[model samples]
Every structure is written in C-alpha cells, then in structure tokens.
Target: MLMDDDLFSSRPEDPLASLARQDLDPLSQHELDERIAALEAEIARVRAHSEAVAKHRSAADALFKR
Candidate 1:
C-alpha cells in the first residue's frame, strides 16, 4: 500500500553505523590510520554543517520573533 514517495523517502542503512560494526581487527596499522584520518575529515565536515544550520535557524527565529 506504500506510495512512490514513501518508498523513495526511506533511507538506506546508515553507512557510518555500518562502518562502526565493521571488523577492524583484520586491518593493518596503515589501514587503521587511514580510516582514522577519513573519519576525522568527516567529523570536521559535519561540524561545519551543524554550525551553519544553527546560524540559519537562529536567523529565522530572530526574524520571526514576536
């Protein structure tokens, strides 16, 4: 009974969650270091987006203040 929009709106499994469950024991030291660097970069990207979103929300709230 699901509509087309409902089917497409559902997200696939979160890759970050999948990555956390991955077996890291098999990775070499260099591989682990590379993974750490990639994760750090992703963290920075997420933080920047979060700050931008917060600023946007704050501006919207200020504009609509009663």
Candidate 2:
C-alpha cells in the first residue's frame, strides 16, 4: 500500500485520518523502514522543487523591478 504521509498529516479532519488512527494491521519492520526511506526521499524532492520555484520567482520579480 502506497501511503502519502504528507497528505495524511495535513488533513486531520479527513476520514482517512480517522481510519489511520484506529489500531490496524501493522507493517513489518522491513516495510516500516522502507516507508520511512521513501518519505524522506519525497521530502527532499519537495524541498528541492520549492527552492527551484522560489528562485524562479525571485528572478522574475527582479527583472520586473528593473
């Protein structure tokens, strides 16, 4: 099951969050580790994307100001 931690964390009022809070089948140690790794990679990717977008916006704003 591909779980998106960001989506899950962001929507506290979502029904899925309620389900997630309930005690359910747990992931194996290996699966847990893999999920953590994937989340970390996703966080890095998102950070990089945000940085690039900020850089582009800053450049555009500078050109407009000149």
Candidate 3:
C-alpha cells in the first residue's frame, strides 16, 4: 500500500507508483497469478531488508547513547 506522501514525492516517477497504476484488465488469469507471486516475493524481500535496517539502526543508536 502506498501512502499519499509516496505518491506525491518529488521524484520524477516512482516505479512502484507506475506499477500501482498499471492496467490489469488486459492480463490473463495466469499472468495475474504470476504477478501476484512475484509481488509476494518482493514483499518478503523488502520485509527482510527492513528488519536488517532496523537492527543496524538500533545497534548504532545503542553505541552512540553509551
């Protein structure tokens, strides 16, 4: 899900925004299924990255606080 801020960001065009706006009507059921699978994989990848970044930030904050 995209926040309003993400949609209105200064970048010329975000790929995720473009992907969200893409027409899905023309896709066949198989293609839609494949697309969903790909998106799920991407979500998993992002979640892992987010967790790693949070862990790193926490470590840095702890070090700086001490």
Candidate 4:
C-alpha cells in the first residue's frame, strides 16, 4: 500500500507547504508548542514585509502621478 502523493504535495510552491504536510504524530508536546510559536513569528515577519512593500509601492505611485 502506497501513501497518496497528493497528501503531501499540495501547493508545492507554498513556502509552508512542506510543514503543512508534516506528520505531527511523532512530535512531543513541547516540540509542537515550539513549532506553533515559530510559525506565528514567521507569519508576523511576512506580514510586516508585505506592509512595507505596499507602502513603498503606494508612495512610488503617488510620486509618479504628481
């Protein structure tokens, strides 16, 4: 019996795709908690970067329109 590839291969382009497909059954409670903290931190970091980029783009558009 073979495991379905789709079970782990969804959205291969996603940065967190591999983590999403990981088996959490082998992780200890402490490890799972740590993983959640790490993912949260990463989400914050990505959001901040996105906001910065959007701000820069808006500023550039305004300057070009003037």
TM-score, model 3 to reference: 0.78
**Residue-level lDDT tens digits of model 4 in 1-66:** 657875786656765786689999999999999999998999999999999999999999999995
**Model 2: per-residue lDDT, tens digit, 1-66?**
657985577646786477458653578889778867977898899999999999999999999995
Residue-by-residue lDDT tens digits, candidate 3, 1-66: 999989897768778999999999999999999999999999999999999999999999999995
Candidate 1 vs candidate 3: the TM-score winner is 1
The numbered model that scores best in TM-score is 1
Q: List the candidates' TM-scores in order.
A: 0.79, 0.62, 0.78, 0.74
Judged by lDDT against the true structure, how good is candidate 1?
0.95
Worst-scoring 10-residue span by lDDT in model 2: 16-25
Q: What tens digits encode model 1's per-residue C-alpha lDDT throughout 1-66?
A: 999978787788799799889999999999999999999999999999999999999999999999
Superposed by TM-score, candidate 1 places the C-alpha of residue 9 at a distance from the truth, in angstroms, of 11
- Ten contiguous residues minimizing lDDT sum, candidate 3: 5-14
Give stretches of model 2 more than 4 Å off. Answer: 1-25
Model 1 TM-score is 0.79
The C-alpha stretches of model 3 lying farther than 4 A from their native spots are 1-12
